[model samples]
Target chain A: MEKTVIDAHNISKIYNPETIPVYAVNNVHLHLLEGEFTALVGPSGSGKTTLLNLIGGLDKPNEGNIYINGTDITKLSAGKLIDFRLHNIGFVFQSFNLIPVLTAKENAEFIMLLQGIKKSEREKRLQQLFKEIGLEDKTDIRPSQLSGGQQQRVAVARALASRPHFILADEPTANLDSVSASNLLDLMEKLNREENMTFLFSTHDQRVIERARRVITLVDGRIASDSAAVPTSIPHEQVVT
Target chain B: MILLMAWRNIWRNKARSIVIMLSVAIGLFAGIGVLALYKGMMKSRIRAVIDSEAGHLQIHHPDFKKDNHPAFILPDANALLKKVQSFPAVKMAVPRTLAQGMLVTTTGSAGVQINGVVPALEYSASQLKRKIIAGEGFHEGKKNEIVIGKKLADKMKLKLGAKLVLTFTDTADNLVSSAFRVAGIYQSGNAPFDELNVYVSLTTLNEWLLTGNSFHQIAVILKNDDDLQVMQDQLKKTYPSLLVQSWKDLSPETELMVKTVDEYSYIIMIIILVALAFGILNTMLMSILERTKEIGMMVALGTAKAKVFLLVLMETVFLTIAGTPIGFLAAYIVIGYYQKHGLDLSGMGKDMMASFGFETTIYPSFPSEKLVMILAMVICTALLSCLLPALKALRLQPVEALRR
Candidate 1:
């Protein structure tokens, strides 16, 4: 049986709670298992990103307990949460936010450096990750020298280099061309299948949804539907290109 | 890696960074140059006070300095001179017979302080011979010869080789007058001293006063100024009845000038550095504000607040330190050149400088301690300048920062 990597019970996030009381994430319960490939889908203002932020420990929920690897992240102090994130989670943003002054290899090695990894081990992991991402020839170049597609690939390589328990990719393909988006999805799927690395994404792209094994839909700050099995709403043939 | 990032970040906006760096450089250059100039000027004035006007130490009959009375001459002038010259620290001691008198020329008359000195001893002790811009000093065996200052000679319409009458009261309370030939005209770069003083032979003045071998003052020059206080104290103890005073006590204005210059030099440097620090603070704040998104991303990617703060601090320090060497090197070159050739202030009018007893030509001197202090101040200002910007970076929340 797969272990539950993330478990949330009745988490709520309220904005202007003193007066207006608008709920960004309302009374949501969620659980993520290891090795699971999931996509969070929703319309605009449906609180998908807020839920992702809460679950990733980047934000705190107004009311609830969120456990990551059986440790309650919501109860942790801000500093401790940051340390926890460094050790247990990786993030991939849509804008491909690699440090501009650093080369690709240095960007990939940043998290490991923060974790106090030795240079040799960091180099070893960087070599393997660059090989997996097919950026071996491009590792010495800064992000400005690379195309948008290549930059996103380096971002993915950076996300996976630390061997975190899970990767949170927020709209990771939103800025890419169709060919680059398909290539990135293929790379992420391959990493999921081979390394059993759990993946979670908050995205509006139909391509991402079609590739995900499980899909959870949010509406009006609450989960409207969850498909634990392979998604069937989008036809497989239409997204296979 | 953080240091590398900091170094690269400063170059992100080359123009802005360069402006701040140049400001630091220029401020330091000005501060250091002004300090060196003031140091040189003060040193020259102090040297004049010690070597020309007053020797390192002076001994007088306690009542003589009170009124320049010829009756209050040293009781044992010859014995006191022999003993003072025997001290190891004393380079040479010369005796002078001082009198408040009047100098009358055919054209005009002026009040004067007459300094009656031995020809050879006074020449060596005060270097009054070097100050003679015209004519010659009193030669040996030249009787009734006097050396008047340029100002006094001009005022009384007197010239070298011209005869003048000096009138003063004798020790026996009788008015006495003597005629003396002016043999030399000198300028000591001290306007008031030049205008009010005239030197004649000690023996001639003593003969005219009918006082045998009596003198009012013994001026002592030391080989090393470090021995001044100790020698003064010894002389004071040995001759408890006489008045022994150092040059500083005799010339309070020169003492005040030295103290004021030392204090003002550091105050000026601090003002310049504080202005530079504010420039740095403004530039760093703008840089941090422009990089809001980048900082937010770093924080979101699990960078600790301390690391973020450090990055900002390192960037500011690098920028400031980059300019320090340039300022120091430029100051060194300019001051070195001026020290060799001198910086002439003749354009500001020589008479004005002479009035304050300073030479028109000044040589700038840079002490190593000033360099160390300026560098220390620069570093302190740099560190202080970075705090506000670093804290501003730390206050940024990752989510909101990313939204920008």
Candidate 2:
């Protein structure tokens, strides 16, 4: 049985008081299972990101409990929680968020480099991840030099380098064209199934939700639906693990 | 890796980087140059004082320095002179008979101190040799031949071979008089000495004082003038009864002038550092603002807060290291240029410098101490200015940073 990696209960994020207390996240409860591909689908201002941030320990909840890998991250200090995030969660953003000064491969290897891994071991892991992402030729190119698909691959590779149990990608495909977005979704889906690594994405794109093993729809800061998709003989569409 | 990244990040905007560095570099150059100039001025001033007045050390009767009176003459200055010559730094020691006197010539009358020296031995002990500017030097064993300073001779309307009557009281408290023929006119360019001091042979002074073979003070010249402090301290312990005074003690005003100029160097350097530190703060703060998301992501990726702070600090350190040397080189070129062709303070500026008793002609000199001090301050400021911005980076939340 795959252990549940993330569990949240009664979490609410309140931004301002005068504006009807915008409930970015309101009493939303959810679970992410090991190796599961869960997509939180919502319209703009629906709190998809707030819940993901709470789940990723990138934020704190005003009231409630969050458990990741059976540890209550809500109780951890800010510094300890940052370490926990580094060790457990990997993040991919819409902008790729690669350090501009670093080359493409260096950006991909950044997390493992932070984990104090030896250079040789980091290089070995980087080689495999780059080959898996199919950017073996663009290793030395900087983020500015790469196409959107290539940069996202590097970001995905960077996200996976720490060997975290799951990945949190916030609107990761928002910036890409349809073709590049489809290519990235295919890569992410492959990695998800091949490595049995759980993936949580807060995205509005129907294309993303359609490929998910489980799709969660959030409306007005509440989870409206959490359902598994019917399995089909869809050989390959996305690579994410 | 973070440091390496931070360093490379500096050149991402080369013009901006150079501008920030130029601010620090210019500050450093000004700070160091000002310090060197002040210290050099003080050094030259003190050297001029010692060279013209006391050489290095002067030995007087214990009561002579404590209370100024002719009665307190060194019992037998000849005996003390013999012992002082044995010390290492002492190049020569000669007895001098000093007395408050009045000089009268056909043209005018002036109050002065008649300083009597041993013609040959005093050559190594006083500024008499360098001050001689006109006519003929006193011939050896020429009795009654006097070398009067140019100003004193001008006041007395006396020329070489002109005779004058000088009156004074001897060590025994008895009135005495001497008539001497002026042998030469001298100008040491020091107002106090050139205007008031008159030089005469030791034989003439002994004959006038009726003391036969006694003197008041032993002027001791040392090989290295800086060793005066060490020699004075040692001599204090060696001969507690004898009073030895360095040039620093001879004229408190000149000593204070040298000290004040030296202190100005530190003050001006600190002010330069303060101004430069703010420029660095602006640059570092801007840099942190530009890389906010990057730093936040690095922290999210498990870079420790301490590492982030260190990374920023290390980058600044590298920048200062590279830029400060350029500043040093620039300062060195200016100093070297002035060192060769000293800055001219002639015309109008010369008169202004006279307020501090400095010559109208200004020279630039480089001291290693001032260079080291400026470099140290630049590095310290560069590092310190990184503190606030690094803390801001530490506070950046990973997710919000990306959203921004």
DockQ of 1: 0.54
Query: Which pairs of residues have clashing backbones in candidate 1?
Result: none
Q: Is the docking of candidate 2 incorrect, acceptable, medium or high quality?
A: medium
Which regions of candidate 1 are displaced past 4 Å?
A229-241, B61-90, B104-111, B167-176, B208-211, B226-244
What are the TM-scores, per candidate, against the unseen true structure? 0.90, 0.92
lDDT score, candidate 1, position B365: 83
lDDT (Cα, tens digit) per residue for candidate 1, span B9-46:
99989999999888888898899999999989988888
Please compute DockQ, using alpha carbons, for every candidate against the native two-chain complex.
0.54, 0.60
Query: Could you tell me which 10 consecutive residues in candidate 2 chain B have the lowest summed lDDT?
Result: B348-357
Best by TM-score: 2
Name the candidate that leads on lDDT: 1
| Window of ten residues with lowest summed lDDT in model 2 chain A | A232-241
Off by over 4 Å in 2: A17-19, A229-241, B104-110, B150-164, B180-182, B351-355
lDDT by residue (B123-167, candidate 2, tens digit) is 655656766888676897678888888868777778889999888
